[model samples]
Target chain A: MTVRELAALPEFEAVCLPDGEREILGGYAGDLLSWVMGRASEGDAWVTIMSNVNIVAVSTLADPACIVLSEGVAPDGDTLERAKEQGINILTTSLDTFDACVRIASAL
Target chain B: MTDKVNFHFDIDGDNFTSAGEASVRIKKLLREMGFSPDTIRRVSVAMYEGEINMVIHANGGSADVDVYGDRIEIILADKGPGIPDIDLAMQEGYSTAPDNIRSLGFGAGMGLPNMKRYTDDMRIESALGVGTTIYMTVKT
Candidate 1:
């Protein structure tokens, strides 16, 4: 499914839809940026609670289709701006990491 | 190889916020040069892990990316404390990064291993209390 389609689901809300047209092929759940970088494949939907500026770099390197900030975590201003600049679609959900993973897995 | 283009960057050891800047820039350059997305991602991830290592353990360093027709060579050098055990360092679950770094979403003991995993070739040269230099290459 495309990022736009995922945003429409009740599982998550599109807080920053920088590239909603990108397609989500799978999902990776991790809080460690390095681990995610090593394991996340291209077009994966990265599910995490990380809300830092480095998330932009990890997303860029991993080329994840989108980033889901679980548990209602909010990114800092700088992170949000950088995410937009890099065309990284970020979604937020009230669900915790585990539930968010389940939701994304089912969606995919 | 004489005609190969080279890009150099000085990684500031003091600022964690500025880490990974070089990798991101290189990703853009490779994209503009029409490299395949997979190759760009490999180079980007390798360089990014090296950059993060320099900031977290080496107090910053210098990175030189040599772009050639068939491959991209990345050499990262730092004057910080060197690695004493290369074998241990290469392990997937070994890290010396402080807790603060872990709090920032790094220091999960995957940096060097990930760098090697993404690059075609990797080498580490270091001297105790002198410095460390990492050599990595990714094929186009």
Candidate 2:
């Protein structure tokens, strides 16, 4: 399913920036960068509460289709700007990390 | 014919957030070199795991990547307190990291296993109070 479809699900809250286009499916939730790097797949949706610029770098290396920042966390200004520059879709939601994962999985 | 590329990085032990920088760079380099996406992802993931282990357990280390016509080799060397039991350390959930490290979402004890999972060959040369070296390779 597309990111737009996932965003419309009841469990997911849309904090998407104006420019991001929703695409890809499958949710991988984990804060451990190493594990995620190993397990997360291309076209997978990453649900993380990590709100740092390096998270973007990790996401880039992992090549996830979209990033969902859960637990009411918001990216720093620099992070948001970098996301825009990288053309990476960013979403934020109020649900906790695990709950967000469950929602994304169910949507899948 | 020698078709090889060498890349070197000094991983910073103190910076938690910047731990994966080298892996990211390597990923970009592999992409630019025209590696297949699967090969690039495997190299990046295995290298990232080793980088994290160096930062969190070994107080940082040096990583060297050798890309050749048929395979990619990664060597991570560190002077941290070496692993006592290579067998135990290779387990899925065994970890020596402190509680604080766990809070940062690491210390899951999956580093080595994941490295082995992604790489075609992995060898650990380590000694207590001495140091450790990991050599991993992924075939193209």
DockQ of each: 0.85, 0.60
Model 1 per-residue lDDT tens digits across residues A1-108 = 899999999878998897899999999999999999989989999999889889988898889999999988988888889888889899999999899888888877
Alpha-carbon shift of residue A104 in model 1 (angstroms): 2.1
Give the C-alpha miss distance for residue B125 in model 1, angstroms: 0.7
Candidate 2 global lDDT: 0.83
- lDDT (tens digit, per residue) of candidate 1 on B21-100: 89999999989989999889889899999999999988899999999988999999999899999999999889998998
> Per-residue lDDT tens digits of candidate 2, residues B21-106?
89988988999989999999889888888898888888999999999889999999999989899999999988998987776667
Candidate 2 clash figure, as a count: 0
lDDT of 2 by residue, A1-108 (tens): 777777777666555444345567577888876677778888788988777766676777788878898988888776777677656778888899888877777777
Measured with C-alpha atoms, the lDDT of residue A70 in candidate 2 is 92
Clashes found in each candidate (C-alpha, N, C closer than 3 A):
1, 0
